[model samples]
Target: MLGRVLEEIEVNVLASQAWELYRTLQLAKFIGEELPNVIEKIDVIQGDGGVGTILNIIFPPGTPGFSSYKEKFTKVDDKKRVKETEVVEGGYLDFGFSLFRVRLEIIEKGEESCITGSTIEYEVKEDAAAATNANASSMVSIQPLVMIMEAASNYLMNLKNNKNKM
Candidate 1:
């Protein structure tokens, strides 16, 4: 079975400003610091923040049946303000999912505003028994992505507001 989920949030900042953070490893660091409950830690396994970079993302302990996953940056396009990462080890793959990928895009809305869109694509092993296949499909959710988007939006908005006060 194949599945996908998408979520987007408008950020009160220039697309370039948002891209500056999204296109680098700083986003992972921000998540670790700002949303430790969602992600406990992120270790760079290889490469820089660009394409081919690999990250070991560890979920907080006690996160039902999930511990960590290794994901590789398959695509990072600064010109288009888009980035993509694929889970190459563990993670949803351990839950009978054959593939899991995430894509994030920043779309300009106005001179000082933009939208951050996140997408998750996954495929379950077809040969898996019916029960496993069913369980894998149920595991796909956009809630986590939604939380990230919300946090990013709030962070960016606060940043812009603070600058305006200066």
Candidate 2:
């Protein structure tokens, strides 16, 4: 089974400003600092926030099933303001998912506004048991990504507001 979930939020900031955060590992750090309950920690295993970068992400202890997973940055397009990552080990793979990938994009809307989009693409193992495949399909969700985008939008807006006060 193949599945995808997409969510987007508009932020009152320039696309370049939003991309400054989303285009690199700073977004991971922001998530760790802002959403402690959703993500416990993220450690860089290799690369420097660019294509081929590997990240080992750890979920909070009480997370429903998997605790951690390693993902690799498969695409980092600066001109397009997009980044894509794929799970290379653990996490959803253990639940019978053959492929789990995430793509984040910053779309320019206006001089002072932009849209932050998050997408999750996954495929369940074709030869896996029915239950496992069913379970894998069930695990696909956009809530977590939605939360991240909302938080990031708020954070960037706050920063802009504070800077304007100076």
- Scored by CA lDDT, what does every candidate get? 0.89, 0.92
Q: Identify the leading candidate in terms of TM-score.
A: 2
Considering only N, C-alpha and C atoms within 3 Å, which residue pairs clash in candidate 2? none
Candidate 1, 115-144: lDDT as tens digits:
999999998887663755366756778787
lDDT of 2 by residue, 8-123 (tens): 89999999999999999999999999999989999999999999999999999989878999999999999999999999999988878889999999999999999999999999
- True-vs-predicted CA distance for residue 12, candidate 2, Å: 0.8
The parts of candidate 2 lying over 4 Å away from their true place are: 129-135
All candidates' TM-scores?
0.95, 0.96
* Count of clashes, each model: 0, 0
Query: Weakest 10 consecutive residues, lDDT, candidate 1?
Result: 128-137
